[model samples]
Every structure is written in structure tokens, then in C-alpha cells.
Target: MKRLADHLQPGARVFVPGLCGEPTLLLRELAQDPERARGVRFVGVQFPGIGSADYLGLHPEAQQTAFFMSPSVRQGLRERRAELLSLDYPGIARHLQQCPPFDLAIGHFSPPDAEGWCSAGVCSDFLPIAWARAKRRVAQLNSSMPRTGSAFRVHLSELDAAIEADIPLTTFSEAAGGSETELRIGRLAAELVRDGDTLQFGIGSVPLALAGSLTSHRRLGLHTGMVSQAARALDEAGALDPDAPITTGVALGNASLYEWAGRHPNIRFADVRSTHDPTGLAALPRFVAINSAVEVDLFGQVNAERNDGALQAGSGGLPVFAQGALRSPGGRLLICMAATAKRGTLSRIVPSLGAQGLCTLPRHMADVFVTEHGVAQVRELGLDDRAEALIAIAAPEHRAGLEEAWRAIRNRL
Candidate 1:
């Protein structure tokens, strides 16, 4: 294979894989020839904490256009060298379909199977769409990548160039034990979940802790956007239904989980259109969507994207799953978070989301709200009653102040 830079041209719009599918070898090669990459534009959806590649820093004139904000792109965003497309998972797929064809699509894939097909492996989110729309396709073939059965695959003949490497896949390890507050919140949230429920959750400390709390449950099913180490624990504990497949867009975990998923018959890696589609999710029985947020107001509105007036993340698949849960029979949308942040000095359950806060999920979409103190079922409650329920679950120290704030807000109404 020729050098990765040889395939690139100035001002090219390159589609790079994100998350665990990131082609480090190709990126390193591109970074090595900074002058050649000038005016190059890198595009993809990078998740925070999972991806940390500064593509814009490769050259002073290099630019990036991404769907999600990450630490790697934050500097470029502030410097006006990067663009953040505020689109949900499904919307992103649509954008890619309608946007101008990319000059090149570079991806990391598992080695060819008996049929000469390479799997997208741990990250199949949107690469397939981009791959189809690109004029040229390049792949970094890694033997270390798990050949997941249900992941998207590309033919060896489809690639314009291929670079072989043996680098380890990126891994994410959640802390073994969470804080006391997280444990309490997890336990409280777990109490709302029942056997035979189909689960959908995002990545975070609370969800990990919730997994630990649900070890005793039985026959739970998973239809989530991202599958993490927590899914392995559920399967091992026999909490997950043996017959149902673990449907997810991506499998993000350590090496052991990857190895397990490679041979596991029940793990299915799907595309975003299927994983995040509301209609498909609503068809599943007892679909329970559990997600965490930065804060929740008495009205049950959620803010998961921003904090302290700064953008921290993207819209993601949360809203889509919430809609599914709401429409599904016997389904529930559980918004789980600690009642306080910043060492208990601030209350997460507030009187209202102020002008600065971005409401990621509106009040009606949240069926239940869980805090360390307790769970508030606010879906059927009116405004006044909803405020009281949320206030009751607030931290003991903040309960009184929250009640006072709610009362003032109520008087204005």
C-alpha cells in the first residue's frame, strides 16, 4: 500500500471513522505530512471521552466538521477552525446522504473473512453511509478488531487502498465502584425496572452503577444505542434474556468484551437508522429507556448537552429513545441522575431550566425521574404536583431551597 498521504489532495473533504473504529495508523501518517494536509477537512461524529484525536491540529489550515463535541475538537471550535453540526443520530445519517459526496472515506476494519468481507467491528455507527457516498474508499485493516457478526461489512475489492496493521483497538473501562451517591441513585433506579423489560441506556457512571444494581433481575432485554461493559455483566448474571439478541449501534468496552462479542451469537451491531429509529423501538415490548442528564427541572425537562452555559455534548440518541419509550406499550423513560453536583453544593433537580440551559428533553418526554433520595413518577402529574414530586427527591440540603424556588415560580403563574 502507498503512504496514506499519497491518496490525499489539498482541500479534500475526508470522512474519518470515530470512536473505536478510528484508524490511528492512517491518522498518524496524515499527521506526519502536515504540509500535504493543509486545507484538508475531516468529518465524523466523535463521542466525548471515547475519542480524543485532534485532526484540526495536524496543520495550521486543517479544518474539521463534526456532529459531536469532544475534547480534541474543543480548541478548534473555539478558534473557528471546526464546525459542530447540531444533529441527532438519524438526522446525521440524513445529512450525510444529502451532503456533497466526500472525497475519501477512511475506516478501520477487521480483516477479511472467508468470503473476503471486512467488518466495521466495534464502531459501525455511520461509516457505512459515508463509505457509500465517498468517491474513494480506504481501509486500515487490523487483525485486533473483533469480527462482529452483525456489524457492517465492506468487500476487499471495494477499497481503493488498504493498510495492514496490528494495533490494539481503543478500550473504555468504567470505574469498578462508584461513589455512594451513584450507588444510591442506581439502586433507586433499578427498583423501577422489572423483569422481561427491554432496556436502552447511554454511557455514564449512573448507567454503569445501574448495571451493578440489576444483577439480581432476570430476563431483561437490551436494545440500546451503545453497548458497554455493563451488558457483559448483565449477560453473565443471567439477567439478560438468553434468546434475545443484544441490539446496539456500537460495542464500546475493554478487550475482554470485544473478544466475547466476536464469538457471541447474541450480540448484533446495527446502523444508526435501525438503532435510533423511534418506530422500530416502539415495536419492542416493555422498552425502558434509562438515560442520565446534567440537570432536571421541576417540570421534568432535561439538560444533557450543556453545563454552566457551555456546550459539553450533542443531542445524540437520547431523544429518539425517549420517543420510542413513550410510544411503546408498557414502556417507560427514566431520567436518572444524582440530586446534586459539585460536591453536593448544587441541586440537579431545579425549579426550572433557566434561559441559559438547553432543554434536551422536554417536560412531557420524561416519564420518571430518579435521584439518590428517591424516584419521582412525573409523567402523569400536573405542573404543581410535578414540582412537588421533584422537590421531594432533591437532596435533603437542597429540598427546602428548591421548594422555595418552586413556590415563587408558582406564584408568578
Candidate 2:
């Protein structure tokens, strides 16, 4: 196991942390002199909101190959900062299990209990595959990581090196709900949603805002990657409509979502396979896949990956739904985000994605891009034209700069 330093080299394939399961301390070693680290590619499925700062964003020297698109990695890919490997959840696990062993893998775990077992902590979905195949396994021990029942814990003897840290583990929370901007995005996304449409709900307050307004709707269904309190509120309000089908692969909350699901019949949990089956999603009529983007550009590219070194918000079922939405005769795939973040100082709609923004949603597949200000249909526009329309939707304060930059360009016209 001490061969950890021997097997890795420039451009070596490394499976790094994932899905709120990153090793922040190991990342410090990774950030070592780029000259020595130049050829390493960190690969895994994690989201920006869940990963460490490096995965949220990566050092230029480390190339990346990911299964699910997260914010930080999306930023890098979009900006051509790094290479990306975009695949759905099934595709990710399939690759890990069937593909060649990786040079190294970074893992997280809780301390071994008296039973000589350690839980995969909060993320067990991909750990088993990574633990077995990766040539070298580095464990980052976090006492705070939840010891969930389904996780597969490894013993300390099995770990090659255990780096103990007192850092906070990641968890997703309801966005501070009921903002005027969120309400606006919610209403528009809701309008596109028709009666009896199967839905994919995402994190953030927009879902809550939209959930409240759906009380009058009927036969609506949910089969998503994650669910929040809104799902319960809708069920209790009789808006969930028991006669209809509802399913999910995962549920999350600050304890409220759990309490609501304990005895609920509507909430059925499934593994990644059934949850994100492209075929199953294709069968649903009038499917509406509503997801949020960090910031969308004129071309409708979506980057839902890394913010730090670790990934928090993996694509989960989003790509599968996006493809399925395209197949549905009347289906709609919407990427919704606030026009500005960071207290309105940043414009979510920019002429181009950031230097590190990766394209999670390829421009062609993107149907609608929505901000608090308004929605823009960029489905089939030229690059310049898409830029023009996107700028119009930018926060009122940032539009001028985008336009000036657009105008300065030398076009063939």
C-alpha cells in the first residue's frame, strides 16, 4: 500500500472524492508542486456544493474526468480549464466496476466501531467499487460523517493511510426560502409544467415556491434524485395525489424530510439503476425536468459541478431526464437559476461561462434558461444571437457590460 507514491504519475487516472465524500486533507498533498503533479487526472462523481474547495475548483495542473457534472468542474470544463467525462449515474458506476483499476482513490469513512466495521459515512453508493479497484486507497477519517445504515464501512486495517481532520462534513440544506426572485423563477417553471407531468425536483428555494403553488394541480408525479420538505408539504396538502405514481432515489433535509417520509406511502426509495433508467424516464409522458444552473450563458450550457475540490451536487438523474425530456413530445427541460448570486454582485447570465465553468448541459440540449428577471428561449440560436438574448436577461446592472463586450467583438456581418 505504501506504493501510493510509486504508481501515480503525470496524466495518471485517479478516482478522487465524491458526493459529499471528499478527502480534504489528501487534497493538500495533491496541491503539491504542479511540476511533480502535472499529469494526474482526478475522476469521480461529486457536486460543487458537496465537494471540497479543490473539487469545487481544481489546480490547473490536475486534469479531471468526472461521471456526473458538478459546479466547480463545470466551471473548469466550460472555460477549457480541464477535460471532463460527462456520463449519467449508471454510466458512472458501470465504468468504475468494469473499467481498468484507477491509479489512486480518495475515500472518506467513520471510525471502526466495536464490530470492526466502518461506515462509508454519508456516501455509500460508489465507495464499494472504488475501494476494490483503485490500486491505492487513502482514507480521510471524519468523526462527524453520518453513520448511515446502508453505507459499507471498511476497517482501519484496510486503510493505507488515515488522515484525521476536524473539518466540517458537507450537507445540503433548504435555501433561505421565500425570496422574491425565487418566487419569480418558480412561477415560470411551474407554468411550463402541465397536468400529469412527471417531474424531477432539485435543491433550493425555487422548488419550495413552486410546490406551494401546485396545490391546485392534479395527477402530478415525482421521480427524482432528491426530495425535500416540499414533497411532504405537497403530500399533506393532498397535492401529491396518491392515485399517481411517485418515487425517488434519495431524500434529504435538516431532519424534517426524514420525519415526513418515515411512514409515507408516496415516497418509495430505489437504487440508482431504476431511478435513472433512461428507458423509464422516456416512458413518462409530458415529463418536465426542472434543474438549476450555477450561471447559464447565451448558449444554454449548464454547469452543475464542483465549487471546491470535492463535488457536492452530482448530476444524479438530471442528464437522463434531460435526454428523456427531449424525447417526450411535449416534454420540457428547463435550467433555472437566479440572475445574480453573491448578493447580486455577480450575473448568472454572462456572455460566456467562467474560465472554469464546464458545460454540463450541452448548448444544443438546453431548452429554456430562466432567471428571476425573465426566461429566454435559446434552443436554436446562433452564438452571437444567443449572447444578445442572454444579456437582456442579465441583472439590470450587468447588462451594459455584457453588451459592450458583445459589441466590441469583430463579427463577419
Candidate 3:
């Protein structure tokens, strides 16, 4: 048992595990004594609850550079103490590997096995690569972290410091079973999935609802970014391959799901490079990628990273996954979202996206669009036809306005 200071020097750039893999002890130490890390810069992605807030709140001088902004980090951004980077999921690994390597990579991990190997557990995102490239590596070996079957294992000999932490691993409840609107969108998206399809499910209620509607499908293979309770259910229903592992980049769920993951031998975790590479995903048979979006315009342009002018999340692996699904034989890319936002006042399906909207997936790459009203298969349609199809799936109240906007654009063209 050693303090983080014993292994880390002050004013260095450190990498902490994002999402559920955050090390409780390490973070608390930083938060409790920010001066210990006064000039240090912390870099990572989404923090579930107390991520960065404690440290940043206490030591505003300690800088933060996030790949994917969390709610807490967003607050820091508002306060002008943090900044977000624009990069794909796989690209995060590449960025960290560049010049002036990270001073220390700190996070949680499973205890060393008899063979002296420690697993990355629920997080396999960029940990392996970060550990390799980092000048120092510190890990909190927690008994509560599920030992997922990830290839990103570091031998005990590689660790600069091993702290035994008995804290509970963070858990997330399954997203509330979708709203009426989400259910409608889910049903339409679920119809696109076929028997023996290799699936990639994204985060958010739309994808969760779609998963809930997929129990009847047979032989679904998972090559996704996040493994949720839906994945566990699919595995139990015999919808997934018993031989081939459900390849994913991260695991996010409650304790029961964690237990299931620990017991299941077919769930394998890989890096973003392997899971999000379009070339690799295209090689899989019958691939189907289901992702959510904030807004999608008549052009089939997808905006998943921002809304109303402010950033919400990152580009993540949407582009690569969409491209991969499109290139796969018998593959389909389904973009699902509610037709309206702001409590039904705003139309998500508009003639053109807002000015701040970043095109995560371009029009030429879109495959299918799903909303509460219906599914729009407009991948090969003309621009006018695409607008018509998209409007058809928009909330009934907004369809007329969207049609008027579309006609105005067509007339000008």
C-alpha cells in the first residue's frame, strides 16, 4: 500500500480511467490534496459521478483535457477550467501515444493471477496502450472489478505501483425502458435486425429500447463499443454465438450484469482500434450497427456531439462504426432518435442542422433513419427523396414545416 505521490511526481500529465474504471482511492487522494498535484493535468473521458469535480473544484489550477466531456467536466468547461478534444474513440489511443508521453497512467484493475497477469477488467479502451506508452503505471487492484476476458493484460512486473483498493466498482442501472416515442423508434429499428446478424449497439435509450425488442432474433453476434444488460440478455437467450466472443470496447452495467460478465467466457473486450476499424468490422458477416443521434437533417447528416450550440459528448466511434456497417456484406447502419426534442417542442428532423452541429456521419454514408413515426430507408435516395422520407418519420406536428423548408431549398436549387 503506497500513496499515489510515492509513485507520481507533481505537475505531470496523468491519465485516469474513464467511465466505470475510475480508481476511487487515486482520485480521492487528488481531490483531497489538489496541491499534491497542483500543476498536474488530468486527461481522460466520461466520468460517471464525481469525476474531476472534486479535484477541479478544490484546485482549479490543476488543468483538465478530456477526450469525451462528462457532465462534471462540462461544468469545468463553463468555468473556463477545462477543454475538450475532438477525436474518434480509436483516435484517443493514438493521441496518447504521441510525443511527450503521459507521466503516469493510473486506474483500477483486477488482481494479479497465479501467472502474474492483471486484467484491465471492465475497461479495455486505451488502458493497455496507455500503460505501454506511459512513463509510469499505477493501478488499484480491486476485488469488486469484474475480470472480463480482455486481451489487454499487463504483467505484475510492469506495474510501477500496485495499491490494493477494496472499494466497490461503479455500476449503472439499465437505461429506463424507453418512452412511448423511443419504443416506437425501437420497434422500427428492431425490424431491421435479422437472424444471425452481428450487432453493434450504442449508448442511450433508443438503442436500449431496440435491444429490448430484439429477444426473438436468433444468433446475434455482438461487435460493439459498449456491452450493456442487453448484451447479457442476448447471450442468455442463445441469440449470440456460444463459440465466438461478443467483442466490445467497454462494459457498462449493474452488479448482476457484472457477475454475468465475469462468469461468461464468450464476452471478450478489445481496444477501439479493433472494434471500430471499418475494415475489420466490414469483414464480419451480417453486421448491423445501431446508434443514436441528437439531430439529423434532410441531407442525412448526423449530429451526435452537440445540441443548441453547446457540446454534449464526443464523436466517439460513430463514423467508423457507420462506415463499417455499411461496408459489411448484408450489413445495415440504423440511426435512431426521437423526432422531437425539448419536450416535443423542437424537431430533431429538420431541413438543415443548427450552425453548431458537427457532422459525425455524412449524408453519403447514411443507411437507415428511425424515429417515433417510422423508419426511413433513404441511403440511395436523391436529396429531395431523402428529405421526403425523413419528413415522413418526423413528428406529425412538425412534418408540414419540414416539408415547407424542404420545398424552399428545392426551389432555390
Best by TM-score: 1
- Candidate 2 segments whose C-alpha is farther than 4 A from its true place: 1-88, 99-172, 306-316, 380-388, 407-413
Residue-by-residue lDDT tens digits, candidate 2, 1-413: 33233445776777765545566555555455334346577676665455454533444566777655456566777767565555668777777888889877767766668876666644555666767898877676767555545325677777667666645555457765688888988887777777777888766688888887776777788877666677766777766658775666445565445445434655665545666777887777877888887767665677765332344455656778798887876778888888887898877776656666766677888787778778777777887778877887789999998887667652533
lDDT of each: 0.86, 0.67, 0.79
The TM-scores of all predictions, comma-separated, are 0.97, 0.63, 0.95
Error of 1 at 257 (Å): 1.5
What global local distance difference test value does model 2 have? 0.67
Off by over 4 Å in 3: 47-55, 78-80
Lowest lDDT sum, 10 consecutive residues, model 3, at: 47-56
- Give lDDT tens digits, candidate 1, residues 1-413: 57666777778999987778878777678767778678889898888878556788788788999887777678888888898998988899899899999999998998898999998887888888898899999888999898887657999998899888888887777787888888998899899999999999876678889999999999999999888878888888889989998888787778887888777788888888889888999999899999888899988899999888888889899889999999999999998888888988988888899876899999878689998889899899999899899999989999889888988988999
List runs of model 1 lying over 4 Å from the truth: none
* RMSD, candidate 3, Å: 1.9
